[model samples]
Target chain A: DQQVKQNSPSLSVQEGRISILNCDYTNSMFDYFLWYKKYPAEGPTFLISISSIKDKNEDGRFTVFLNKSAKHLSLHIVPSQPGDSAVYFCAASGTNAGNMLTFGGGTRLMVKP
Target chain B: GAGVSQSPSNKVTEKGKDVELRCDPISGHTALYWYRQSLGQGLEFLIYFQGNSAPDKSGLPSDRFSAERTGGSVSTLTIQRTQQEDSAVYLCASSLDVGTAVYEQYFGPGTRLTVT
Candidate 1:
């Protein structure tokens, strides 16, 4: 079963616009959530993360908002650039899982210049 | 300051053949994880190892699939009599530890395996 899900497979937006990526989870045990960006033929790199206790966390141009009650989380990239085009995967881990990250199917973001 | 590294970036083996993939975790990192991404699918956790701790094999798909971590550094994943469905990109990742704090994992470029 897929505990984490990214419903949107692909998203397109104009450069300098805002890009929003959404993820949902069914496992309440997950307490830490993270986002990773990946380019073709490369490994995913960590972007940002949020704890279950917090609702939002921001770094630079990327922001992650979490809603515990809705079991939903989202990543927002402000002033999206063409370099932001890649597959973004959301992952989650719980204390019980021993740092094993369960990842979503990933959403491909395309920023058109 | 090297990140996780996996060997044999690409492998194409025939069905019924056995293949072994290797992974070298970042230096001094005590936690190692193995995951695979199949076509049009998300990453799937396969196994995990921590400093002398019993490896977690809960995610191994079958008895044919197994992994071993030697000297608490490098890891090897072996698939025996592999089927065509075993084709996927196997990824390795490492972190400082698996303590209470959530440590961000660094992943390797991954080893792509294709069973022909």
Candidate 2:
């Protein structure tokens, strides 16, 4: 069974628009959530993270919103640019689970110029 | 300032042949992890090693897979007998430690292994 899930396989957005990617998790023990961006053939790079204590975290054009009650989270990118095109992965980790992260399948984001 | 590094970016071998993949973590980092990504699938945790503690091998799919970390810096994953189903990209990551508030993991370019 997958503990973390990304329902959307891909998303497309126009430049200067907003792009939203969603993820869901079944494990209630997960307290820390993170998002990573990956380019083709490259390793994933950490983007942003949120603790279960906070409902939202933002950095520049990227924002992550978490709904603990619903076990869902969404990443929002405003003024999306062509450089933002890549695969986005959502990962979660429990405090007691050491440093192991459970990752969602991932959503491919394409920002059209 | 080097991140994690992996060797033999791509490998192809016949079925039943054994293969070894290597990973070198960042200097001074005490935690290392291995994962496998199948086509169109999320990463599957393979193993983890922290300091001098026992390595976690719970995620190994079967007895054919194994890994070892030497001096807590470099790790090698070995497959006793390769199978076509074993074709996938193996990823390595490392963190400073496991007890930190921000358990950020830095990853290395994966090694793509193909068993024919």
lDDT, each prediction: 0.95, 0.93
Q: How many pairs of residues collide in each model?
A: 0, 0
TM-score of chain B of each: 0.97, 0.96
- What does the interface RMSD come to for each candidate? 0.6, 1.3
Per-residue accuracy of model 1 over A1-113 as CA lDDT, tens digit each: 78999999999999999999999999999999999999989989999999999999999999999999999999999999999999999999988766889999999999999
Which parts of model 1 have CA positions greater than 4 angstroms off? none
Q: What DockQ do the predictions score, one after another?
A: 0.87, 0.71
Leading candidate by lDDT: 1
Model 2 misplaced stretches (Cα beyond 4 Å)? B98-102
Candidate 1 positional error at A83, Å: 0.3
Candidate 1 chain A least-lDDT 10 residues: A93-102
